[model samples]
Target: MPTFTALTTLADGEKARALAESMEEMDPTPDGVGVFEMEDGSGLWEVGGYFTEAPDEVALSLLAAAYGARPFAVSELPDTDWVAKVRRELVPVQAGRFFVYGSHDADKVPEDCVPLLIEAAMAFGTGHHGTTLGCLRALDRLMNAGIEARNVADIGCGTAVLAMAAAHVWPRPVLASDIDPVAVEVAEANAAVNGLSEKVICVEAAGFDHPTLAAAAPFDLVFANILKGPLIDLAPSMAESTAKGGHVILSGLLVEQAEEVIAVYSAAGYSLAHREDIVDWSTLTMRRE
Candidate 1:
């Protein structure tokens, strides 16, 4: 079956989110909608929707106009084996000592690096994106610094690649949680494929809301690769959940927004330990003291 996509851009995050929400109520509603900050540092937010059927161009245009966004660009995607295409195109990504690959590239995994099998699917964090890559590199730096984390949590973990990477080095269970249940399932599958099902526990929760996460309080290390808004909002909770002298790795924000995030975390009792900028994304490692 053919698929369709409609995309628009606006300067305001609120409008972009509102426009994406409105796409959900449209006739021939989208299978999914997303609002993401453009990494170009244009202060633009992209709102996009995907549909199994052709989306209503007129409705999309109207929504864009209402939201003060650019005209919606709608396209009909060619019918093809998207999964196979992804598998063929997404080569294994290496960050520091970690290697992220799909089942298709299983043979390409290096014996010297930590291998994390993340099948090309609906979830995020395959380590190809700059955000995930930066996070992995930051984690590797921490490991190289002789930091040992007995307890770890990966909040908003998509494929749980980061959690699995930590599990590969630390002899402890790594808690991985995501707001989306589908992501949680993907994380579990990825962990199983990486032979880390026992070490990387997956759960569905927003930030640190789950009882399982709450019970495992004061994590030695935490990974939050979510967006800037959620990261800022999570500062206080992150500080509370992190043990003294623990570490937090944050990403999914543009490089330009790093200072703002740092300031917020600083107020929450976190001091920046390391910062790595890859392309347009910035990954921050903060120490709780």
Candidate 2:
């Protein structure tokens, strides 16, 4: 079956959400509607709808005008085997000491690297994206420096790959938390697949808001591969949750925005230790003072 999508962006988040809500009531109503803030620090909200049938473009245009948004770009998605495509295209990624691969590429893992199994169809942070890859490399650097972390936390952990990596190197339980319940579930499943189920504890929470993460506060190492805004918002909490002299590895930022994030964390009592840039993304490793 063919699928269709209609998407647009608006500067106002409330208006974008209202537009998405209205799209749910349209004829040939969307199977799903979503509103999300753009992660690039654009201050724009994206509103989108997915449909089994083609959406009415005129109606979408009118709705966009009503919401003061750009015209919706409607497109029909091809009926393709996404999983097969992913399996064929998503090759194994090697970041320093870690190797992230799907089960289909199980035989490709090199003997010298630590293996982390995350299916291509699973949640984000598969180590394919630059942000996740940078974080993995940052962790590898810390390990090479002989840093021993007794407690670690992976905030906004999509598939718990970072948490699992920490568990693989350190003989300690690592806390992994995400705001999305589905992501938390995927994280748990990935942990099990990596045989780190006991070592990587997954939870559903935003930032450090959960009791389990709070109780496990003062982490020796922290990973937050989320976007720029959330990273800024998380600095104070990150400072509080991280132990003095502990390290926090952060990514999901454009190269231009890395300076801004560095400033925020610096104000929160963190000093930049190392930075690596992959393509257009930047990953920062900072030490809590």
Q: Quantify all predictions' global Cα lDDT against the true fold.
A: 0.91, 0.92
Provide the clashing-pair count of each candidate structure. Answer: 0, 0
lDDT of 2 by residue, 158-233 (tens): 8899999999999989999999898999999999888888899999999999999989998999999998888999
Q: Which candidate is the best by TM-score?
A: 2
TM-scores of the models, in the order given: 0.90, 0.95
Model 2 alpha-carbon drift over 4 Å, by segment: 39-42
Residues 1-289 of candidate 1 have per-residue lDDT tens digits of 9889898899999888988888999999899999888766688999999999989898888898899999998999999997878877889999999988888888999999988888876436789899999999999999899999999999999888899999999999999999999889988998888899999999999999999999999899999999888999999899999999999999998889999999999999999999989888899999999
Candidate of highest lDDT: 2
Worst 10 residues of 1 by lDDT: 116-125
Q: In model 1, where do residues sit more than 4 Å from their true spots?
A: 10-21, 37-45, 65-69
